[model samples]
Target: MIGARLDAVSEIAESMQTHRTSHASVLEMEGADVTSSQTEIHHIIVSVLSTIGRSPDIQRGLTRIFHRKATAAEFIAVIQAILIAAKQLQQLCIIEDKSTNQQRETLHSVLLRKLISIASSSTVINGAAKLLSALNKEAADRQDLHNLFIISDGKFPEVAEGTRRVELANEKLDSLIVVHRKQLRIHKLEYTSVAGITHLIELPLNTKVPPDWVKVNSTKKAIRYHSPEVLVALDELALANEQLTVVCQATWNSFLTGFGGYFAEFQAVVQALASLDCLNSLAILSRNKNYVRPLFVEDDEAVQIHICSGRHPVLEAVLQDNFVPNDTDLHAEREYCQIVTGPNMGGKSCYIRQVALIALMAQVGSFVPAISAKLHVLDGIYTRMGASDSIQQGRSTFLEELSEASDILKKCSANSLVILDELGRGTSTHDGVAIAYATLQYLLEHKKCMVLFVSHYPEIVSIKNKFPGSVGPYHVSYLTSQRDVNGDFKSNEKMDHISSEDITYLYKLAPGVSGRSFGFKVAQLAQLPVACIQRAIEIAAKLEAAVCNYTEQQIRRSCSLSHRQDGCKNEPTEDVLESDSLSSGRVEGLDDISELYRELFLNLNFGFLEEHGDDRRLQFLMQARNLAAQLIKLWSSGKSTTRDLWVGHTSWFEL
Candidate 1:
């Protein structure tokens, strides 16, 4: 129940923030300055409704009504307040009849007028009247319903009779108090009530002398007693009060029961109020932030999104003037997929999010945080971002990431806008790249949606080759110093590694792919141990060199094979001989240990051992022991490097 209420409130808030202000009449307003009228309307809305929006009481009441948890009193109060505001807004919209010229109605005025009409409708008026008539006039006036039912014989005879009896009982109690005061000869003596026991008289301990009086309690200074007449009155009062409570409860239940007929009407009023609230909110946001209205393409047009100088609405608010704005352009007939690559913390995610947010704000009819925007209305916005594992569901982080990606693939269409950030980063690099690649291919070739993809994997950028003109590569531009002339680290060292001090984030999107993610800089910024960083750099460099060597070898071998196929029967070239010599040297270096392992495994006849029993098995075991001893001895002497020994070999036990 609480979740449902919260969801309703959230929906209301979102609607208010993004409610579009466009109307045909406003769009077609002639001889009137539309922008100025809009500004004036925003000012009026802010002035009229800002206080109500900030009132927690009003907001809570509205939320209750929205969720149908409100009592008649609560519903009446909230509707009364909204109606009062609507009237005030209506008066503001009214132009004097004395004016010679008529004023053209603006969009804001039209919306305000619509709100007033809804508030003043017969349904709302009759419902309010019925509720007020059923409630006590004084309680209704004060907007308090602690005593809900009207104590009138005409409206609720049972409640009225119960009330009369309670009143008469109270009068009888008062009469007894007067009699007791006169008899005690103490005019100031009054009834002392404690813990709901009413009409007990207190007197001096020595002065009490009535046998008919019942002793209630006594202290040193005073003795308390209830006269016989007072006890009878008290009992009548208690019974009358109880009866009144039961009657009042029944009346209140009946009142609510009758209200069910007006539930749909009141619900409509609540919806109108919600719309009014959102309109007012949107006006305020647009006026304060100088947001521009976005122009949406017609349904017949091709899908497109073009934003000029767009800024992230949230980040801009937080960053103020420091937030940098960037442009976005995508079209189904042109570059529909943007592969965004940049260093960590370079604002890649922020840029994509900005684009998505602007699109969403535009579609929802809210002014976007941009200088200008023109886009086809996206049918849906799909995003797969961040990383999380569902432990309770027994799913790993990679599984969750892929699951979201899979859902996106299944659901997204050509008219949708998709944002994927580092789609497959929760697993191995090769697998991550493969999954990310396949996902992008599916989106481009099949879904053909407008995609803003962020990835650290450089290899995924190659998808542009298969989908030419539709895929565009971009990077969040940044500046770096303390690098070689080629804009990289020294050739012998890691090419992408850079100290945090040497890099500066520009936070602007630009063309072309980023060479590296500059993750080491991020690690440095995170304050990882210096020695650990250096060791990582060393390991990274070795891996990079090994990969480069393997690639070069493969290319050369392919080239040689091509040349041989072309009927060249000449001596091997220097490059070929060098490659052969390099390859043969490693093999020759590990030949001794390799031969020992070959003899130890290949010479053992398993079938003969089983038939000959322990005698033949004993000989094979002795040979295996000698081979293991020789292998350990060779390794200890470091006759060959471990890399060379393992380069072309599997396990030593393999025959």
Candidate 2:
């Protein structure tokens, strides 16, 4: 029977079309392919229920009601027995698919009623009272009839409690057995229980015995005789016992008929119990994991995901306290788009995935792995993270990336969360950067959604310049400074080893673009050939220098535009002196505003110069000092006021 039910359910599930937002009717997860063991469980339940239907032990008990033949205690016992036997488990395939909160609460109320009926002497607990009331009515009617039969031990039997009849004929028969015992001067007078007769065993020949007694068995030293009078008593006892049993069966049959009305409530109580079990497990898990409940924003509120120190759930479980937590603040306004870049193995992927997982957890009504989180309901969470291609379906890595990206672009809205990692990475660097930049620009302008785009391509940071208000740059930080292990691995040596400089991963997320991917160092650590590693490093240096030189040229050309628009009288200095330009004394006629700005700039520039050991940035600082002087000279010479000069500034940093 259960197999047939499973087949029917499976067929219906297969025919239904799956939707992203479909509720799957009680979380059946119908088409998700439940395990074979669950199917076997259904079969076992069917067998158990079938055995219950065939059991004769409960047949009379279920049919009979607790009349005056039993006390209130026995009545409660009988009801409890029936409950234990009649109840069956509702199918629960998975934890997430249990009944709704409202349903469970309703069932909980029903269970409370059942408990009250069991505990209270009064039979008045809603649905439960109906059956008890019916039984009590019948019990009152049989109050006088109680004297018609008597239980032998005065209590219900642990196995089977049989009613004893008090008919006059039965009393007479019982008295006859006593008479036989006294009169038989036979060695032993015994009652044959199966034959329902009194017999005399080892009757003495010298003793006065009734000649009417018939010989039943003869032994060498003992003779057994059955009395005709005992046979008549046995027949009377059998008839009396049979008549009382008929009334007992009638009472049981009436009880079952009334019980049918409340059976549904009992089944509902079982379902509620299962739901409570799940809740208890969740409570225990929450306590152990230190998970906090997520706060969901109201429907009218803006879509936002603001998590404080949210850690990756899976990594936190595996690494425990070692996992570094990070904050994720996403809104449709300023924090709409973020470009995360970092060195290899710096936990960039982990950071973005943690945010996604937290969002997913919050939407599913589970506590997230965060100190605190407030999130708005999202339509969907779209991830174009890892490359999951299907070569069997003739799809390459790039094609798969494009397909997923295309879907995200087409369907994602402002309420959706988009996570992309290394988009266009399968292509050449030139084409890949262009594609990545365009995609970033499109998402910034059109999608206006919360996006975490992680990539090794530093050029993608250009979007932050374009949409500085919303798009931002972030990186998982690392301690690049070299450290020694017991002062081993000489500073000058270059052999691949697990040196701190080569393999230190901080797993910390910070604002701004990440540094180089450290691919060559990673390769060296992987034990690549020494000569090839050296050759790769030499080529990488040339390529980096060429790109830096080109970028610097573009910046220099752009600075002229700033100089022209800043209202400087004389042509701006062609370049700043690289060596000790700050050693010169402060220029006169500079207002407090210009002087304060210059001081702050010098402090930042000098700090960079000392830390990076880069002379080029020092040169850039010199240029900035010269531009400040020019602006101050213009403000003092009456070409423009300090206010207009600062206001009409052409550089991006106009406050």
Candidate 3:
């Protein structure tokens, strides 16, 4: 297989050769003629092939042709024929070495490389392409089966000369029969089932028969007979014709097999043609996709990848013009690790995959789908991208994820390209965040390779401050706007309510942290139940409020732990409550109300901030605030004061 892009090989040769070598100089060889025109030489070859009578003739004709000037077309033609034969014989050669079980170079591979090298030369490119086209046309037409060097235009000289003698004898016998016509009667000529046996079916009535005549078949009215001398002549004719036919067949088979001796030449030609074909295919792809030949720096230590306006090759092929292109810059100095956070439908996976593909394509010596690309040589590309479980192997999604990640860390080097998406997503939130952080840290501090880490965990992005320049924080841009909003509503109700078209994904990668993944929006996109979407929206709002309040410390409360007798330790002392109650004239205002119920709040888990009642409830609503506000309203009904409420709730701590 001419697997390497032949254009790259051509370029390499061009760089080394500097000035182009002329076609005449390249075609003119040590043992070949330097004077004859290619057309004349081709005619000479066709003549030699036509005259081939036996294996010896095939050998001599081919040797003579080889001594003549070898044009690129003629050379490629013979090589093409050899390739056709090699395909049948390829099974005879081992594809790989058994001892090492690795790809072992064989004589087959060597000859193939030589052929490709020859075909890629400036002298042969045009001539060989045209020659190959003609040869293929011949194959399609089934007209060019001249590989055996057998001359097919006319009968062989040996067959013709021998058959001529037999025909001449038969003609003389017929003449004798005509001469003897005055004396002998006419007869019907016929043949028997026996080989070369002829007979006279009958003679004319009352005809005079020769004295040496012998009757073979007798009819009722006439006798069938031949002269003894004529029979002898007929026998000789049969022998002569039989010998001639036998010789012709043997010579024909031998002539065709004669080319088998020149397998080496045929193999070289086939290899060259295959390489040229591979180059043509890659050229077409490059042209159609607007691909650019990536630039490579000579410095091996300067490992990096810089792409301008790079598009996903497969996506561009499919979506064409509509696939958005993006830019990437990953270097050894900084931006070594990119933590890409975005909404579900954003192009994070696409972006990372494009970079890796471009790297692979560069290594394969093909142009990449980018306006400009400067890349370092990568040893290999490692990816843990999607959620693929190994059911047959008994590996769950998380287990598969861990296994792939482990292997990447185990084998990847500084020159490798690593793309990881949503690492550790199959575990608990805290554990997943921790594992993701650890994985990124391992790559950054140890591997230091070009990495694209995609994650949804906002807690994971905290590492940006830890690695600063080495780790980048980026997300796909999106828009968040209020739908059908009235400014007159209070802060609480507006904050809790979510409306349609509340989130619009931009799909553009922007620097800094993304606020959220918009899970509810993605759920809606997935066509999840409407009730499910509404519930998710409500929980998300509550969680957001809880997180905001936690960050601002706006609502602090006391806890009345009902689990134990000493649970109310977090509550304010009796003396302090009494002092505040006396300092404030009416009832104590609800400031620092969180401290009043500190024990109860302390028992609440972060998960409780989600959906408080049912259905994996995740809400940002402050339940503690509502309870406090209700309690204050109840007491201010002129029935009880703040101090009296706390005293009365003393029994609530009795677990």
Candidate 4:
């Protein structure tokens, strides 16, 4: 009966044709495939109402108010009447069905079972066991009266206080369980030809069976064997069941008629949920004082990200069970990509992910974890920091990293923010350096997106020199001291335990480069082999010396070539003489700017120098020396005015 009602609903839904939004259309398409599940509840309603029709009093009452015709409208009116009656009985809804394998039956059936159990304990009727006997006789004698009864007393059930029947119904519904089974069946088949060959064909439905069966059976035993009230309650339930059948039958026809109008809309909504295209379904959560996104003004200027004390909402939630989250600040005007360098487990990954999450919140149109936020909408956000690899896809970890990075490069625009963590670690040192360098250059020079790069490679620090003032470094602080294990000389381990005051995790943008990678302390914390760590340190020392030696060799060769040119006959004698005088009188070999310039251009003829160049460079150099002398004189004279003589101007060019 339930299956027939569902089929009818499916037909009605299929016949519905109307224009729908993208979201709505998808929902309807999904619903059409499984309209049976939704219609079952409604069908139960029709069945209940049909059972109610067995009582002459209810029939008379309904007929007086509803049209006499057995049309769809009359069916709905009757269903509504039953619903109203149920509502007045303090029940929200009802559904009945066969029991699942091990789980109880549908929500309504469980509720009916509970009600029957409770009613049997009442002390109201006489010879209650005989009540079922009489009802079964009546039902057999008059088929229409099988489950019908009239509540001449109109008394409501009595049980616990403040517990509405509707509330109980909802509770039972909440516990409704569905189980799925995991099973696979394989089939072999032969091809069939249209004209010549007669072939075997195999069709597989892959028909699913319950993975885990949930059957519904009361934990309750019939305790009213000798109680009269139990019989009275059984009689009431029997009558209620009769009314239930009539209601369900009527509901089925009503659903068939009206379902055509609403089924399409309902289906579209379901499909939308399945595809996760509800766009507005995602939620944003944060706990910070700064905004995570760019804000746009009415005039169209964008609001920059100025997150202070900001953190990743997901990370924070995870950490809440253990450690505290550090606060951070990211601003467009002051910071774009922050080169975060620190010891391992120093929170670099956490910081980068937090920024990405904040941006994600903004793109999806949600508030971020900050005190106050204004965001310019972003197109999309990309994150590439964590470890994920698929060997089945024929990609190594490094290859996968490069693939994701390449994809990001192709897709990210100026409005996107890219986060990279220890990129290029899957290759040789030189190759990794080259890749890291080129990747950063592309992000800065081409992509022009907001970026946060976390790396252990020190080579990236050279970027400050290449793109002066464009790059800045921030490091996590650790303790350092002067001590030796044997009390003879200073030990490197003294710097291992950095003081708390230094671990600002300050998240502040400051000038200068990160000090050093505290990998030793980190290794200690991780309990690495001490011998391996010492070997690594020894290798690192050798590598550093080799690099320095190579650099010095290049500088010495260049210096030799310059000196040979300096001693030529056409040399500027006066500038050379000045440099010699300064060198002779100065501390060590440090020369003032003018002296260095004189030494630099000693071979050039004075006439040629004047003809080819303006005096701005020469005058500026001379002025710099004069300012330095004045500063020294003031220090000796203990007078501030002596220094004031060269207040502003290009004097600001001092290193």
**TM-score: which candidate is best?**
1
RMSD, candidate 1, Å:
13.5
* Tens-place lDDT digits, model 3, residues 541-619: 7877876665333223222212334544543333322333323332234445344455234323332322222221121
Per-prediction TM-score, please? 0.69, 0.48, 0.55, 0.43
Once model 1 is optimally superposed onto the true structure by TM-score, how far is the C-alpha of residue 419 displaced, in angstroms?
1.5
TM-score of 3: 0.55
Clash statistics: count for each candidate? 1, 7, 31, 52
Predicted model with the maximum lDDT = 1
lDDT by residue (tens digit), candidate 2, 1-655: 2222223233222222122234444256553433322333334234434544443333333334322344433444445433433333222222233444232111112332233233222321344544444334344346533332223443223112334443666677667667887886433565553243343444554556688877776556656666778666667667666665666555554545546665445544434333333333443345457777777778788788899999898999999999999988888766788788888878988998999999986665556688999888888899988877799999999999989888999999988999999998989975777778888788878988889999887767756767877987888887554446675534523323322454468888788776467787778769999888878877876765665564455245324334244543432233323222322433333345555355435433332332223354454455565556555655676644565646654331331
Model 1's alpha-carbon lDDT is: 0.69
Candidate 4's residue-wise lDDT over 1-655, tens digit each? 2222223222222222111224345457754423333333333333333444443333333343233333333333433333333332222122333343343322233332333223222221122222222222343245442122222243211211112333444343222211001122322222222333222122233333243322222124311111122223345445555455555445434434443443333233223222221111221122122223334333254324556556567765666534344444443444556677765666778777876776666555444665444444455677777777899988899999999889988998776777888888888865776688788878877866677788777656555555554456665544444434454434453243221112223343343445465566666668889788777677766765664464344234223323344453442322433343333323223234343333323312221122123342343233235334534544467645433433432222221
Q: Itemize residue pairs with steric clashes in candidate 1.
A: 16-278
Q: Which clashing pairs does model 2 show? A: 63-252, 63-253, 64-251, 64-252, 64-253, 65-251, 65-252
Candidate 1 structure quality by residue, lDDT tens digits, 405-506: 999999999999999999889988657777888889999988999999999876677678799999998999887666666666433233354342277799
Model 3, position 349: C-alpha lDDT score: 92
Per-residue lDDT, model 3, residue 363, is 75
Q: Where in model 4 is the C-alpha error above 4 Å?
A: 1-257, 263-299, 318-335, 363-365, 464-470, 481-483, 486-511, 541-655
Q: Rank the candidate models, highest lDDT first.
A: 1, 3, 2, 4
Q: Poorest 10 consecutive residues of model 3 by lDDT?
A: 611-620
